[model samples]
Target: MRTSRALASPAPSPQEIGRAATLALHDELALSPKPGLVTLTDRGSHADMDAHTFMRSLFALRSYFVRIAELGAAQAPFEALEACGIAAEARMLAATQGINTHRGAIFMLGLLCASAGSLAARGLRPTVDGLRHTLTQRWGEALARRALRPSALPGGQAASRLGLRSASAEAALAFPTLFETAVPALRAARSRGLASGPARLDTLFATMAVLDDCNLAHRGGLAGLRFAQGCARDFIAAGGAGRPDGLAAAAALGAEFVARNLSPGGAADTLAAACWLDRLG
Candidate 1:
């Protein structure tokens, strides 16, 4: 992570912050060898959607982040942010012809961009701490109330069935996994001189090892989720993407995930959020 000194420059405009969020989603899509997830080259575990589907969704959502950010800059109530997100999700579904390419990103990265806007409006540059603080301070109670409602989304329903933490729960807690796990893993890998691809790969695997990915559970059930986590843990135990054969190992893992029809979409969303935060600095 960059120091606060590095972040002392003028805060980015809402449009710039929104653009970074879109690019971060693109970055996640362009990353190859993602276990059980869509990439530019292949549809990992999903047959319904591919990289093109994701691109169209991203294009549709280009303005949404900015709108949400503007609302956040004004310190608008949580209802306003939720309404923006609901509309964005509709646009994403329309763009992908009802395919859910970026639903998770819509919620997670949208909130982050809004937090960034909040900081900028307050004449502060975005730091991880600042972003988290803004999000919680501005809408923590609303998020908690939102979490109490039964989720209708497939992933959230699956999480409920399995007694796993839903995405809303993570949000209400201010996305501990994004700040505590994914961002740190990405930064540590980069600080160790790893390239972007390897660093992201490391972060993905690290995230998978711990995240109770509802997508995986929805597709493959509890057993499948455990299997995926075990694979990720083993990958990290073997030095993650730092080893010479790391890419090959990741490719093999991707193949295995496909065969089992498991997708760690939650972890992928977290990785994209981490990428967006990295860009903010």
Candidate 2:
């Protein structure tokens, strides 16, 4: 088993961070039957966005990760870092025509990029533990303050109404879901000798089963969130992608989610986070 520290190396360059972010987003897009998320074959549960829209959004925000990484390497203040996020969000909206394709990712992955930068600056290797440590050590308090601020996004509002953990709370805690659940799930599947696609599928299901995804609640309320979690839990319990019928079962779930108009964007974001961390190592 890999410890939190893992291996230490020099901080990654801005270009490295940018490449990792882009590939991570691509990995997420490539995963199929992600149960309520967009992919190459279909738009999952979303009607307004498609795979092409996600491609555009990814292209638009590709540079933001690099620039934010530079800021992190420079040790910029949290507000300045957030300003970059706001700009990136606007760019994403512009590309998707006001659609929220990657808002959750912009916050979660963007911070990880910045944290990687900070780690590089401090002469630490950009390992999983390093990124998490930099995020909490350097900006954890600021993230906590941001969590207290009200958000205008429906997901944030819905999370509050449902008494669920908001995205802000996840960031403030340096992403417990990513570190504690998503990453481990990915590693576990790989250790079991599963292929990349299967590993990622299992990882996504693991996150969905536990995460208090605001997007699900925003669209379907608490009932919606519970439904998504149950689906994910059942999938995992049924051997996930390891079973011969797993892919078929997941495809069925995807159809069901689209019909129900439920999307687990939060889980998708964490899945991407896991991809990013794996790539870094």
Candidate 3:
């Protein structure tokens, strides 16, 4: 699929990049019956956040993406780009009343947004491969250094405590999960003629099956993470969203996850990343 509606025009503006990113986020939040994650129809496994909270968070983050994209187009330093992320996190916190709604997205999708801007600056189309290449070629060293910096966030702390790879590590390596796993799964689903929503659910489950979700480990330890992975594997084994009972199977798995207090937040972030990349292509 083509990345843009108007490929004949010049590079996209910062506002255009930001709007695409925000809409991708909204689509992720709205995907219903997502196992062990928040969705428009229900809170899934989370009690502190709901669809409304996600909406508020998205509202607060609209301009942050644009500003970061502009910074990328200008070839700003990593610190300047990070500053935009910091401010965006503050806004997200304020909107969710300290609920930590979209912090992971702020990091992963924020970098992709910047990568898109960098592509535009070079007169390149914002294809998925282009975005990944721009991220590594333009900011690979900086991301490596950033990965070594100790994080104070709960997710970061949990990742360190458990010895799981940090999100920063993934970014430093150009997001193997997004590129190798989630995006491929999403494309496979769409290529099979699945609608956007079902395709996204399949992508989410595919991510959940493979991701070492720090959120699940944080909340339920290794056992919980394993259980989540097992459920995901079973869902996919049963044909994922392709089966007539696929959506129902997903909903049932979600109920089981909630009972165990297992929320695959990391997998959810990966789903959002896949959604963003899909929009780009």
Candidate 4:
């Protein structure tokens, strides 16, 4: 009798899941020419933070991801997960000396890591759909309630003022953008034989085109958000990153975003979540 291939490989350990989450964030950080976002080589729209600041924050949060995964594997309640996230955010702020480098990632990716852990604990192979299901089944109600509460964060405040979809709402919806838009865009680009760099560029633009990025609203208001969306649409219309001059065009867009101080941090987080899902496979 031959053993099944799925049985031959064990489910990823909690620690491994945590490490993958960290690397997924690094993937987002390394992707350059991201309109109004930070990269290893440039600070796209921020005057207070650079690559070094992000690096410190990443280093600080490494253990938090592992702990959150452990909690998820134990099937802990949403409050437990929220507590872990709150602690992680504090560490990140401390590491970056009060600069919020990975605040959004802490919430979005932290929940994702927890969902993956839940799947692994049940002897289930973590797929995109499995993770989403686990998240909704386990914590969707809590997330919905969270969406109803007032937020003190600048991005959340901006989203409220503009009547845009907040991060909490995205989580309550089980991250429709991450599963529906960003992941599909990434998978499609990769299947089309685009390199990692170009594939991510295409995915980023695809996400930016649709995400109600609160960071853009916070920085430059509704007009700025619309401007970023228009730029993203133009990029996608121009054949995306698959085109010969696609990367060049993306870099130029990044310059324009910086000039206007518009940053699509929400879209960046979604892209990182998609990357994490892809890596889980």
Candidate 5:
């Protein structure tokens, strides 16, 4: 779907970028209380997670996201894969899923969130989808830029990156990568008759609404989503069951951001999570 609305105009300038980076660093340092394991309580109880633990998880997740924003700004192919020490995977995802680092980040994050929901599709520590997404977006964007131009990327590709380039081709939905990431879970929800079409719209709206309810400005509290997603990711890595309430909270907040940006059409993942949480609630 066409995104008539843009991502809330990116932080005004590089100064803002610096501030964001600083804040992100601060948040990660704060999560040191919870080290490796993230606990998600099933009943009306939560494992005692302290500030430090939370910060560590946040720090790890930050790398996953900043890499995304950076990829979005990339201009070449060689640099893309090398952006985060992940060039080969970018090529693989591109070949298999038509995803570059730009699109891959979204696809991967969505997959992580969805996998977290299931929690035990396998007993192994699940791959951190967000991390993979970051690697993909970095390289993909570099590749996209290379395809757009003919130049040595951060690294550069020998051959052109495009298999098909059509003026009529829809611009890839790489923005809001989570939309792509969340597609599988969204589809499963629909197949199980657990969701409404474009269900993510409601989830996005609901997310924004909840944030509004808590007096958290969308810009200010976006970190909360990052933090929460990190916590969820770590929990899954430790084989913890999904937290229905946490899932709902994340979806509701996601909806809020999309609704405010006027791109509610791309909320399939958010809504699907909301449906799952609602059912599990």
Candidate 6:
């Protein structure tokens, strides 16, 4: 519910812009953690280290939410990492006793990152009051069920149907494409080459490699998402006998953005990924 303007883009350069984004993210993580809860800030402490990591992870919940909510699947590799952490805690909390307090705290943080207002709102206010209703209705129920059922994760049949499973699989397969194809293609297009992105190559590249694969697999129904893998394959190549890259519609917009009329080296690929997800939705 904090009010602040998103840092304007058309930024100095991809390096500068992404650096700022990363710093902002870390800042959010530092400030808004769950009070009196174990967290990353407690790292290296002798006591409650694991609990601290779990809770510290929660403290930065807003950063996680803002990243996913604003960036969508394209740039969501960052968010997915956090989401997985939350999933792990949720599972642990369900099975273990004497940690109910920490369990509820983690769940609230998860809702903050996963629900409508969390990722869907794009740095705006959390709107998916549907989340609040669901939490109120099912959180305790889920806890009770976990006790009897002994299953750690929630969402039942709904999780797979929601496409996280598929996305996870798809993201697995997307590595060759993202690194071999997309990154190379953009580097060739850019005058900057690898120099344009020392920082992003390590973090963003690895993250995008995962996210793109997941988004494709899950078809998580992102906004502005459409296009297929092979659809743009020919376009990325040298002379396709027609257009350079055959990206059209959402894909075309993505390609152009990747080509640098948009933001940075990875921006176009990420944006295109976003466009494709939008179509699925």
Q: Against the true structure, whose TM-score is highest?
A: 4
Flag regions of model 4 displaced more than 4 Å: none
Clashes of each: 0, 2, 0, 0, 37, 28
| Ranking of all predicted structures according to lDDT, beginning with the best and ending with the worst | 1, 4, 2, 3, 6, 5
TM-score per prediction, in order, is 0.97, 0.95, 0.95, 0.98, 0.24, 0.25
The order by descending TM-score is 4, 1, 2, 3, 6, 5
Cα lDDT tens digits for candidate 1, 1-281: 66675365789899989999999999999998898899998999999999999999999999999998898899999999989999999999999999999889999998988898999998887887898888789999999999889999888999999999999999999999999999999999999999999999999999999998989999999999999999999999999999999999999999999999999999999999999989878
What is the total number of backbone clashes in candidate 2? Answer: 2
Model 5 residue 100 CA deviation (Å) reads: 23
The sequence of per-residue lDDT tens digits that candidate 2 reaches over residues 122-164 is 6665776777888888898999999999989899999888899
lDDT of 4 by residue, 1-281 (tens): 89986698677778988898898899999998888899999999999999999999999999988999889899999999999999999999999989999999999999988998998898876787888899899998999999999999999999999999999999999999899999999999999999998999899999999999999999999999999999999999989999989988999988899899999999999998888877777
Write the number of the candidate with greater lDDT, choosing between 2 and 5.
2
Off by over 4 Å in 2: 1-10
- In model 2, pairs of residues that clash are 9-125, 11-120
Q: Which one is best on lDDT? A: 1
TM-score, cand. 2 vs. native: 0.95
The per-model lDDT (C-alpha) reads: 0.92, 0.91, 0.87, 0.91, 0.31, 0.31
Number of clashing residue pairs, candidate 6: 28
Hey, what RMSD does candidate 4 come out at? 1.0
Instruction: Please list the Cα RMSD from the true structure of every candidate, rounded to 1 decimal place.
Output: 2.4, 3.0, 2.6, 1.0, 19.3, 20.4
Candidate 6, residues 178-258: lDDT per residue as tens digits?
A: 334433444443433333222122223232333333223222232211232332333333232123232133234344333
lDDT of 6: 0.31
Shift of residue 47 alpha carbon in model 4, Å:
0.7
Q: List ranges where model 3 is wrong by over 4 Å.
A: 1-10
